[model samples]
Target: MMFRRTAFTVGLLALASSMYSHAEKVEWSQGSGQSDGIVVSDGANNNARTAYLSISSAISVPAIKKTQEEVSTLKRELAEVQRNAEEMKRQLSTQQNQAASGLKDSSANLSKEIDDLKRENQSLKSALDDVKRQQSQTASSGSSNSSNVSREMDGLKRSVEELSRENDKLSSSNDRLSQRLNDMDRSLSSLESKVK
Candidate 1:
C-alpha cells in the first residue's frame, strides 16, 4: 500500500509539471480590456480551477506591455521612413532647378556666339566686295601694257581667289556651328523632360 501511494504521488508530480510547462505560454483573451488576460488550467480535479486563476493574473500585464512596446517601435520606424522620403524629394527638386538654370545659361551663350559669327561673316563679305570693285576699276584703265602691271593684275586675281576660298571655308564652319547649336538645343529639351 505504501509503494502504491508513492507511485501515485510521482505520477501526479509529473502531470503537474507538464501542465505548468504548457501553461507558461501567455494567451490573449478576446475582450475590451486594458490588458489582455490569460486563462490557464491544470487537467485535474479540485486544484485546477485555483491554479488557472493564479497563473492568468500573473501573465496578463506583461503580455499587454510587450504588445504596446512593439506598436511604439513600429510607429517610430514609420516616422523615420517618412522623413527620409521628404529629404529625397527636396534633393531631387534642387537638382532639377540647377539643371534648368544651367541649360538656360548655355542657350544664352550659344545665342551670343551665333551673333558674333554673323558679324564676322558680314565683315569678310564687305572686304571681298571692296577688293572686287577695286580690281574692276584697274581692269578698265587699259593704258599701260607693262610686264609689271600684268604681274600686279595676276597677283590681285590670286588674292581675290584666296579670299573667296577663305570665305567659303568660313561659311561652312558657320553652318556646322549652327547644326551643333541645334543639336545642343534638342539635348537640353530632352534633359528637361526627363527631370520633370
Candidate 2:
C-alpha cells in the first residue's frame, strides 16, 4: 500500500511536469480593428465581407442572422455545461460531507476504544495490587508466629516471582495491542490521503 501511494504520487508529479513543459505560450499581435484585428483593407477580401455575399449591403443581414444563431447555440451549450457543473459541485459537496461525518464517527469510536482499553488496564492493575497486598498480609501474619520463617520467606518469594511473570505477560500483551493500534492508524491515514 505504501509503495503504491508513493508510485502514484511520483507518476502524478511527472505528468504535471510534462504537461507544464509542453504548454504553448500564445502571444497575440498588437494589430487592432483587423481581421484577426486589422481595420482598413480596400481590396475584395475584408473581415466585414464574406466571399459568398453578392453585395456589400447584404453583409449585415445574413451575417447578423448567422451570428445570432451561433450565439443562441453557444448560450444553450453554456447553460447546459453550467447546469452540469452545478450538479457536480453539489455531488462533490455531498460526498465531502459524508466523508467528514464518517471520519467523525470513526474518531469517536477510536476514542471510546482507547478509553475502554485504559479502563481495563487500570482494573487489571488494581486487581494485581490487591492480590499482592493480600499475599503480603498473609506472609507477614504467618511469619510473626511461625517457626518456619524460611519456608514463609520462600513462599513469599515464589508469589512475587509469579506476580512478576504476570506483569511481564500483561506488558507484552499491551505492547502488542499498542502496535496493532498504531498500524491501524497508519492504514487509516494512508487511506484518507489517497481519497484526497
Worst lDDT window (10 residues) for model 1? 46-55
Off by over 4 Å in 1: 1-60
Q: Spell out the clash pairs found in candidate 2.
A: 33-38, 34-37, 34-38, 35-38
Model 2: residues >4 Å from true position, as ranges?
A: 1-57, 143-196
The models' CA-based lDDT, in order, is: 0.70, 0.59
**TM-scores of the models, in the order given:** 0.63, 0.48
lDDT of 1 by residue, 1-196 (tens): 5566556655654665676764534343433343332344443332343222222343357778999999999999999999999999999888877877787788778778878878887888888898888778777878487676678778878888988888888788778778877877887787789777
lDDT for each residue of candidate 2 in 67-173, tens digit (9 for 90 to 100): 99999999999999999999998887777667756755665666566666667667666766776786677666755656576666577677667766766666666
| lDDT, model 1, position 117 | 76
What value does the lDDT take at residue 110 in candidate 1? 76
Clashes of each: 0, 4
TM-score of model 1 (CA atoms)? 0.63
